[model samples]
Target: MTGRHAVPEAIPQESPAPAAAPAQEAAPGFSGRLTAPLLIGSLLNPLNTTMISTALVAIGHHFGIGAADTAWLISVLYLASAVAQPVLGKLADVLGPRRVFLVGLVVVIASGLVGTVAPSFGWLLVSRLLLGIGTSAAYPAAMAVLRDESARIGRAAPRSVLARLSFAALGSAAVGPTLGGLLVMVVGWRGIFAVNVPVALVAFGAALLWIPADPPGRRAADGVAPRLGLDPLGIGLFTAALTVLVFFLLDLAHPMWWLLAPFAVLTAALVRWQLRRPDPFIDLRMLAGNAALSRTYLRHGVSYLLIYCVMYGYTQWLEEARGYSSGHTGLLMLPMSVAALVCSLLGARTKGIRGPLTLACVLLTVGAGVLMFLSGDTPLAVLLLAGACFGIPQGLIGTSNQAAVQAYAPARAIGSAAGLQRTAQYLGAITASSLIALAYGQSAGDHGLHLMAGVAAVLGVLLIVLTVTDRALRGRT
Candidate 1:
């Protein structure tokens, strides 16, 4: 949860004052100070997520765990982040994005410090939990902050703002594995976490200097405590539903498929509870009422499921089965990131969502189909070419889907809508992590790689079909 939902009447309100007038700031597309720091802050989340991909094999070796057991490192972070992003977004709205953003940076700093010296896998897991909760704040809060600026200035959000945010996220993710590989070789696996400290500090200092303070009277009355507005019952039910679902998928290789019954029951109960609540943590009603919004959410989820499977699953296979050094693997993976960066920049000129989405699906299918041919002896050039194929979709999906959701959602609920989009993406990530664990129970061999690619191909096909059939995506915004 990133930004605050609408407050109930009984609850105290932020000051009714209008935002400060925009200064005669001069920047070609956006306010440089604001955009630069926000972009830097946003980069932390995706950078950390993908950097860990390259370091996973080393961490597993150090812990003496199999590939399946080691996957918890990735899954747990996404799980925590999936739940945290919207909550923090809500907090940002209630308190202030500046305060929440600063708190998140502090948490990240602390997480990095703890993770650097952890002696056991459990301790590292704790750090990742902190990282997940901390890093989740920046993007949604950034969105809220930008929206506030737009309203205050009597202008729409600059197209460059969303474009830049999307670029930073995907660009950072594209570079993370290669960067992590180099860092692993130079300073060992712990460098992956330790490196966050300095970068986060820079972002903190920059944000403190650049991001504006909230307007006067923009907080709950000091004497009277503000209501949290969280539905404890709904949260419990939703958490249980997601927990059981993820666990069921993770345990698919075992006899725990029966857990699906409880998961279904919990999901139904959650929907019922949310429908009745005035301020549910997750607005199930909105999702159900808005078909286009719902489709965007599902599409984002499946798109991420396919990408992360390749990002993490492929990296593991390259190292363990193909005998490539982490550094070499990172280099080979560069084509995907570079291609994504290029395509994202190009795709920004596109007006409607359909064209980019269709291209994304096509690229994804091609990439996944190519993966079917991967083997221990696959040519390096061919593998790099395949990585580039995957990269094109990576670039397109984030930008295209973000635009679609922003266009489709109601004006007042944009914050919640953005949070939901992140939730969907992270949920897909969690599913991908579980699938990775199941597919590569021991090692990422030919069979596992082929199966994962097939899954990606299926997701790509579904996305293509959705784009073709969904009218919402066809019209210009």
Candidate 2:
């Protein structure tokens, strides 16, 4: 369970849906009780994801597994969610967000229940798969709903939407770790999942009443219902390619040598098929057509990779290595996450200025560099200082980059653009986790920090090159 804040400027580039449409017209803000329920319900998405993160040790203890194996319990959920999101966004566009949102809650509730009571590791993985699928449905649905809500409110929405979304996304991010820590400390890991089951039920019930349906488009008759005609062969091959690819990388030191050949072949095949298909799963058109948007996507990918490696690795290092309580580990991460949200709020204020892009590049570039420096055996005060400098700036830069991509995307492709952008993020997280694991393999302490520093340096150089070559961005603000 994990979530990140949505950047400001997440609007649909094209004419999304006319305001008259059911789903197109945003639901009115409720007066009292509905507001709190809806807000809390919407937040469950983030809460569920982030809760499991700090609870890994408890999970491992329950299953009697090692850290490496338990790590997959987290990583696999992200992998499945990333792969499923683009497809789910298309469903949201067609079937209507309200429908998808409800479905997502239902899936989440069931998965949470399963995880809460699961008897074995195999069942736990199965439950995680269900959770991933549910989560895939929520992000797009939430974005679409927010977009519609903004439409009803006119231009004032995006300004405030960041805070609202951030509160849900980043707020939940901050809360999840702490709450998860508390839950694990109390009843165990299952208690974390147990809590989610009730929350999901409430969200589902409220959504059924408060969320509205969409009017029909010719292409979207009956609300983007799942089709039997989906290309199973292509999807299977693609999923297999990603699976083998991840498995191979995650086991780099051990090297599943034979899996590499199949992984390569399947990846090539998936690429070829995607290129030929009229409706590709990867939405290469959105990715390839816009230079700014594409670069933003890449920037986001690199940034997430760097962020997750340090944040995730440091958590385990804090708890397992340093003997901090889960609560304290969560507490330690608070400053960075809070700094990130604060930076986002500040960045949102400066949107559309010419300097935003440059400011973003500078912030992330320097932040990445600083994080590299702090990754070593730095003193606590020095590390905290680094967190303030780096976390705040990167938070601002990350959302700015996201907003830029959405701002520049082609018409009618907002869903693809958003989904693709997020995919870049998840891909980075997944890659970073594997790479950092490989780097840290059996090393005593802080040895892997250098590998990440190398990554930060390389990304910083690339950002500089890209910023220079793109003349439109220079002094454009």
Candidate 3:
């Protein structure tokens, strides 16, 4: 049982009839109660992901490892989530979202406990892997649950439900590092992981009380639900291909040219295999037809890559190069977090991806460009101002990309499409971890930080161009 926060895939196939209810109970906000538990669950994944950024230096110091080696803590988790989220989402569609959601919460609890007492770096990595797998379940399952509720109660639109979840996710992301910094200062680096325990426990109880059970025999009655014939072969090949690709990317600075051979071979095989299957793990043909959706996925990955570089990359440099304590570093980074919260709300109201996403790219460029102008002795006010600019994109990109995905994904494949959207995001996170390691090398410094920012600037420009010129992103039908 694992879940990550994701958009609910599609409308259910069999939406029998809406149940009779009082007028007050039939309103839109009525479904808001269901989001209470789902919101709590949604926070876990993003919180765990970003909170550790503030604590990474402490963990590396404790383990006597370099920045590059300790980066695996970030990379491994994203990698696991990228592969696991879609699979778990499919399971939620099959086994019942409530059941899967509870199980995921339990896994998070166990992972937190393991992390609290981890005696070695290896043990900590294991805890992160478990956490990634477990947290991956929440979003997809919650999405399923939300859709089911909409279906069962006869709601024409559940846009508000998703907005609530999205806002919760971004807000948690904004708070993660600050909360982690406080915990690290109070209870050492381990506190970041330990914190998940109490939060997950509350989420578990709420989920049990709020989320309704699956309508009996939904799966049993649909004897031919695609879950019955999942494409194991396609899944295996895709996972293997992705793993090889990750290795290749992580070793990009090195002369590991030989790795590309296997990566290319596996990727080709995966495409061929998936295309041949009657029900593929990922439908390449659908991706081809839904060009807008594919572009959204790519934009998510690229945008997140830049975001993580700021989150983890900049945090590491502030501590290692600028002599800030973990707590102070978190405090300094608050402007970015706060700005993201404000901008996300504004971005949500935009008509399409072009405006919000372009604004996101512009902000990204401004943030990263500011970093390139700063030295170690640069004013704290100036640095914080740059962070504020960076934070704006944090909120905007997420909501805009999610809206685009929802608009473009086919009704039936919504769950898988949402999962893949998340996968692209995680892949971006993984790429960021790799880039941070490669850029920062043995330790973080101003030079490396500047280089990373330059890379971010380049990405921002590319994203702007794509948003305007790409057919998929230009609001084409």
Candidate 4:
């Protein structure tokens, strides 16, 4: 029913060129470049999350405020993201992922313009929320485009290409901290965002020119484009439920016991509503029936949680306890990006071999080992090495896990599949970080390190569990 369903192949061939009209002149691998802009253009959205993190303390100082109060900039973005993913994803599939992606590009560009003139932290929060809204388009839209392109190729790509497509997209995350940090230093945090304006312009221009649109003559088997009739009511309920849930949990450190009751009530109501809907915003059945699929989603979610805890928490520690500058912190994170980038590319060669999963498991276990080894007095070299270890897994997790999910998900429901995938990514991050915060967040030094290691160790074990479950599930089928 979705635009992403498998299309019948035209003929047998060694390589299947993607389905689309050729432009005025063709270059080698033209379709690849045609698709590149989607992923490349989308990179800055997640990059914003990483780059702004190191600057939070500095920005707080600039605004004459405490870091605690200014934490909303980050939370608001996450809140926007958690709420935005389901709705924007549904709309992208129906209205056109390209159109939805452009909205994100525009939102980020406009936010940069506003941040250039922001008067206070409150104004910055307003800009960040808009930025979040725009970024919501990047991941789902990028993946959806790639999914469609793969289907259009009209021939099965031997799986490696699929892995390559995903990891390559994820590999862009490696560029985030490195690029964002350098920009923050050269032009300040606003400049970090302003960089998007040019990238968006180019991507917007390219999308209009190169990316193929669904042809006019072919009617969808469903009569209308599946996107035309997305369940708006389901979308509303889903977003409202998630936004409220994120808010309640995000404020948990305040010990808001008064909110606990109502939050629970609202969440329960949302689930019941979704269950009864003719077209639930997210299909719970797909997630429920598939163990491999479910494990992939759970691990994907948990992995990001671990990475954020490491990335943000370390950024805070380096500044508060060890006296590193924002520039230095970003610089230190570069090796991580490099490690992740390399593995993601290399992972393209390792599909279904257990190589990617096994390597990921090894890297995370070692990364956890190195994290536990870190200390306030530890030398910078050792800390950077620790990050590199973590980066290897961080880089592969998004792409590799996504590839696994898609490899196993039913073909017709790529949008919902991705929605489920993105959902786990958000859920993993929010739940894991929230727990880590509760355990040792108040303490600002080595004690936090020790406690965080315990959290990482537990997560590492969970990753192993995920690996086992995936293997067992694959075996059953």
Per-candidate TM equals 0.91, 0.81, 0.93, 0.85
What digit string (tens of lDDT, one per residue) describes model 1 on residues 1-477? 212332211112222224453352222234888888789889988888889888888999998987787777787778878877877877887787888888899999999999999999998989998998889989878876775565345455666677888889889988998899898888999999999899889989998998888654443333233457767787678778877877777766784967989988998888887777777887666666678888999999998888898889999999998988788888878998898888788777787788888888888888889998899889888889888888888888888887777677765556667778888998888889888888889788999999888887887898789877998777745
Model 3, span 116-219: residue lDDT tens: 99999999989999999889899988888876766555563365666777888888887788888888988999998898899999999988887887866554
Candidate 4 C-alpha lDDT tens digits along 295-411: 777777777777766666666667666777777888888898888888777655544524566567667777767777677789888889978977888766776666665566666
lDDT of each: 0.80, 0.63, 0.82, 0.65
Greater TM-score among 2 and 3 belongs to: 3
Error of 3 at 352 (Å): 2.9
In model 2, where do residues sit more than 4 Å from their true spots? 1-50, 146-159, 216-234, 352-379, 386-390, 442-444, 449-472, 475-477
Which scores better on TM-score, 1 or 3?
A: 3
**Collision count for each candidate, in order:** 13, 10, 13, 3
Tell me, what's the RMSD of every candidate?
A: 4.5, 5.4, 3.6, 4.5
TM-score of decoy 2: 0.81
For model 2, residues 238-259, the per-residue Cα lDDT tens digits are 7888888789877777989999
Clashes of 2: 10
